[model samples]
Target: MSKQELPIIDASGPGTACCAPLACKPLSETEAAELAPLFKAIADPVRLRLLSLIACHEGGETCVCDLTAAFDLTPPTISHHLKVLKQAGLIDSERRGTWVYYWINPEVLTRMSALISPASPAPTGTA
Candidate 1:
């Protein structure tokens, strides 16, 4: 399907019923379809590590050289993985002179986290 065909999630938009935690209720078909690519992007070990490395880096960004050093794979392989994460909207990059740097799109991660995170449960007994 074309990118436009998938449901769009607006994190900053007014809240909707769909914002409720996944464990609290089932996802609508649109929600599921919209999120599947994000899940798929992080399903691979390399991409997950790349996410962590970029997200946790100092100054909120990391150079491609830094990311490549942590993996045993060739630069092309790492680049391909980074491309997937970029396409999934998990990360953003910019070219500066000779090098490219990447940073996590915090809003996207926050939204994803909020979607999967459970709400606080009621007290089981009197506090």
Candidate 2:
């Protein structure tokens, strides 16, 4: 159950992989069931685009109105997608007067990035 148990490729290390290859063992049914919804949320293109749009925005956040304009979808459609992102812990929201603003959660991002790849560097002999 350690992070090394996952498959991870780190470009930072001359194409070195930092974690163990996936197990020959299949995921337990409970584990697969647990992971299903989180991946399903990201499987939608609109949600991924919304995440990218917000991520690319300066200050790492954007008003819901600002997000609505980027697509040719109804407000409710956008709201549904944002809801999925929120549920997945990919974004956080705050209300300011009439608008809802969302920003990426750095902590969650860091956790995900590390899950994708693990990197550990120790100072070598006081260098």
Candidate 3:
């Protein structure tokens, strides 16, 4: 199968948060459409854990073999979860020798975090 290029979020660029914080402003239809798939991809319990494992792995990357051992499901099931994370642009993978190595895409995570992060509190006036 051909490798798919994951979406890259430019967190450092101006107005690159993908959307304003959830409580700060309502999302435009286009923004919601673009962001919903990412949330959907990670909504599954297996995929959520898979994402956490990859992000927390030492050196920020891990092989498919390592991930499989953490779950009671078969390797294929783990692979499927990885694929969902990959397709959501949450994680990236590369085939190294006999195993596929995966790592989190930090920019996407940053954008997601920024979107959901609480807005800063208003400053209080001193009497």
Candidate 4:
């Protein structure tokens, strides 16, 4: 009988797609496709700034009217960007009586932070 048998053939070991070495765990193809549009939505500086403002606001949310005033673009232009954020699942909007309110999706932000987090600090030259 071979020393190595069914246990050796298990794919659920360390550094595997099914197990340990957490970062090495592969993202499914479908997940990558779904995340592409979300990253694309955040690629623009304007969108990032807008999101920051809304996220940092006193109420943790902002009305569309208040949001437009801070931008040089027309209200419709701001609305368009907000719409993209909404579609990307990075934000959510609610109609409060008349005006609409927008807020950040903290879960999405957390995932993005994890995705872009540096693996290690750069080495110091003169140590």
Question: Candidate 3 at residue 4, lDDT?
Answer: 51
- The regions of model 3 sitting more than 4 angstroms off are 1-19, 121-127
lDDT of 2 by residue, 21-123 (tens): 1232354666556445655767898998998899999987899999999999999999999988787777889898999899976554443444333234233
Quote model 3's TM-score: 0.78
Give the poorly placed runs of model 1, Cα more than 4 Å off: 1-19, 121-127
- lDDT tens digits, residues 15-107, model 3? 443334576667767667777888898899888888889889999999898899999999888888888888787888889888789999887
- Per-residue lDDT of 81 in model 1: 98
Query: How many residue-pair clashes does candidate 1 contain?
Result: 0
How many residue pairs clash per model?
0, 0, 0, 0
The alpha-carbon lDDT assigned to residue 11 of candidate 2 equals 22
Question: What C-alpha lDDT, on a 0 to 100 scale, does residue 62 get in candidate 1?
Answer: 99
Question: Which candidate achieves the best lDDT against the true structure?
Answer: 1
**Residues 1-127, model 1: lDDT tens digits:** 1222222444443243444367767777977888878889899999999999998998999999999999999999999999888888888888999999999887666667667656532333413
**lDDT assessment of candidate 3:** 0.74
Q: How many collisions between residues are there in candidate 2?
A: 0
lDDT of 4: 0.67
Error of 3 at 1 (Å): 7.6
State TM-scores per candidate: 0.78, 0.67, 0.78, 0.70
- Candidate 3 residue pairs in clash (backbone atoms < 3 Å): none
